[model samples]
Target: MKEEKKPYFPMFVDLSEKNVVVVGAGTIAKRRIRSLIEFTNHLSVIAPEVNNELLELETAGKIEIRRKNYDREDLYDADLVIAATNDHQLNNDIYSFCKCMGILVNVCSDKNKCDFYFPGLARHENVVVGVTASGSDHKKARAVVEKIRTIL
Candidate 1:
């Protein structure tokens, strides 16, 4: 017998005043952070080093960057968080802590540990479309998003 997994509900949240914290500013983190900054002003990224785009956003005062290794205390005030570190154990730790704190968290590498999945977004003048494959097929999801982007 096969038990069906529950699907994630898609919802648009208001992050304008929410404190969103991202641990690790590598490729995955950078991608998600860029999207998040579009919806929220209270965005923070914690990592030992970040890429040029992230640095530019910080310089523009659009986001706050903590250029240091991630610490548990860094998430103490987070309303939502994204664990995008290269270290699996660290991502797990962040997931566990967010679970305990009742904070929403997305674990980039491990879908099972994620409280929410970051969808592929396609936005136009005033319309936005979010696409996901329930963590089963990222390429397909991105392709669908691209199609939607062109349509929009």
Candidate 2:
């Protein structure tokens, strides 16, 4: 039997001026939002209820917040979308919607639904190392990250 290898494409993206949208305002959503802020200055968060952390970010003028549930129109102006809602169906919906629009999306509920997986990342100064097992074994990925951490 012929073995097939999955394609891996790596690219560096400059999110400095991109318009990124995050759906949901829970803890997971907050984490995703915070990470995005590190790379981009333009961030839009959509959720009916905002958590204290996100509210704080809004108060600091770190990101734009929309107090409303997600709608298809929300993805129109987004350069990237992060579906971090606790509702799995909603996340799936957002993922599908992004696909139809040819937009890059990350679904927190399922890695398979995401166009790109968020790997375990270690940062020191300006150096960042990301580790991933392509969703096959996250534990192994974490182990790899630990090894990388020791070297960095």
Candidate 3:
């Protein structure tokens, strides 16, 4: 007999004051950084180079930007890590390191390597509806989110 897989649902996580690290400063990394800012003030971005948006945020002191390549030491003291680099191998390595450190990690390139999956969401007042396909289909999740958007 096959064991049943548990279903995971969207949760309202409190990230205020939590230390979150984003590994990259490209377009994808920038997007994740933007979302994280809404949740936590203690956020850091690590990258050899940063785009204009990240530079602006760094200059404003909204986030601490480490203008350097990813280092194992960078993972220290981080509650959450986001692997948003375009290099798939680097992203995988970051995920593996986070796993060993028992830190929660999200890999933008592949969902299978991620410890947590972020879904497309729709918000209404305090209510938030998140849609995910459990790594099977992002398009389907997007479609569900669109439907939810129409309803809410």
TM-score of each: 0.92, 0.85, 0.82
Look at candidate 1 and tell me the lDDT of residue 41.
83
Clashes of each: 0, 0, 0
Clashing pairs in 2: none
Query: What is the lDDT of every predicted structure here?
Result: 0.91, 0.86, 0.86
Clashing pairs in 3: none
**lDDT by residue for model 3 over 27-136, one digit each (tens)?**
77887887678678889999988888888998888899998999989998999999999888999889989999999999988867877877787777767777888767
Better of 2 and 3 by TM-score: 2
Check candidate 1 and list the clashing pairs: none
Identify the candidate with maximal TM-score. Answer: 1
How close to the true structure is residue 4 of candidate 2, measured as C-alpha lDDT?
Answer: 82
**Winning candidate number (lDDT):** 1
lDDT of 2: 0.86
* Candidate 2: stretches off by over 4 Å: 1-8, 146-151
What's the lDDT for candidate 3?
0.86
Q: Compared with the true structure, what per-residue lDDT tens digits does model 1 show for residues 1-152?
A: 99998666899989999999999988888889889988998999999888889889999999999989988999999999999999999999999999999999999998778778788999997697899887788999999999999999
Any runs in candidate 3 off by more than 4 Å, and if so which?
1-7, 124-126, 147-152
lDDT of 1 at 141: 93
